[model samples]
Target: MPSSTSTSVSSFSHHFYTLLLLSVLLVAFFPGAFHYLSSLPFAYLSAASSPSSTHQPSSDQGPTTTATNTMSWFQKQFSLPPRSRGSYLVTDHVASAVPEIAQYKVGLLNLFVQHTSCALSLNENWDDDVRADMSDALDRIAPEAGPKGQELYRHSAEGADDMPAHIKSALIGASITIPIKDGKLATGTWQGIWYLEFRQVKHTRKVVATIQGEKA
Candidate 1:
């Protein structure tokens, strides 16, 4: 009976050792097995406890700031009417007339007349009738040709048109400065700028448009 009891206890001890050895052998051969088993739960716990990662823009990435820094100063010039006229119209097409000029985002525009008789003004360009009316009005104010100061007034040095041209220039003006925004003339919706050529004969009138702003 004592022998049988001892044998049973020894067998049980042997079985326990075998099970422990199998467990260690499995862990040693499949090294990543334990790691894989714990990975899912570990990942869940880590994600729950930690803050989420996200992307953010720096100062350089900001649109307005980038635009401001990228902007550059620029200038340009254009001619209008091609010839002297009694009535004329100015349009925004003038902006595109010079493709190179349009590349700059103009902030300030200065319009200059090369000739003394010619001048600049802002008016409606949409309607031809308006231009005709303006011409008629100017004609009424200063008639084309007639005697100056009765029959004999001294100063008539540079032809009849010369003095009259000077007078017309005085009545109208020479140069005008216009504010530009987003690379465009900032004239009112109904307003347009013009170069008034007072000469009767077709003259090469210049419209010097100077623009200052950012480059493309």
Candidate 2:
């Protein structure tokens, strides 16, 4: 009996020494093992204390109810339309339009013009001279009725301004995207949105402005 007990003790000692040597070898091979093992106790404690696991919903309760509850907290959506002709400052109009489309603060402001002849751009709106200078510059670059104008463009079924307008639209572009923050369009202090009307005749112009952001 004494011999058997000694054998059992020697076997346990050998196994313990082998396990210790293996652990040391693993730690030496992988330095991060110690950090990972050290964190296990804290992770176990955190899992034990987490409220979500403690308050799990019953299986009979449908997930749809929770989803519905979450969806009900969302803010309402909104949309606004504004039209302009000739030259106009649309900053105030944009500011006023946001209240109708979305109750939350604006994240992104997208201004798009439907007509190819008309377009949107950002420039100084404080002085009339700025606008006049822009108009004059455009005229200098692409005149309304001239030799270059007549030779380069032939699709003038809509009269002289038609082709010129198309040229100007191509030079400038038809859409502008602006950022919105705190219920206002976030443009530079000197910058303002401009609606460039290329046609000589009076025509109603439509501008579609969209605001996207999370609700307050």
Q: What's model 1's overall lDDT?
A: 0.68
RMSD of each: 20.5, 10.7
lDDT of 1 at 180: 67
Model 2, position 38, has a per-residue lDDT of: 95
Tens-digit lDDT track of model 1 for 1-216: 579889999999999999999878978999888688769898889998885554446679874332343545444555665655565665554566544455656566677777787678888868878877876787667665555544232445765556666777888888877776665677888888776777767786766666666654
Candidate 2 off by > 4 Å: 1-86, 147-151
Q: Estimate each model's TM-score.
A: 0.57, 0.58
Q: Indicate the residue-level lDDT of 122 in model 1.
A: 85
Give per-residue CA lDDT, model 2, range 1-216, as digits (tens): 579889999999999999999999989999899899999999999988877733657789755343221111222322223332245566676566545434445566667777777667899969868877777787768676676544556787887678878888898887787765664567899999887777777666666666566544
Report residue 143 deviation for candidate 2 (angstroms): 1.4
Deviation in Å, model 1, residue 192 alpha carbon: 1.8
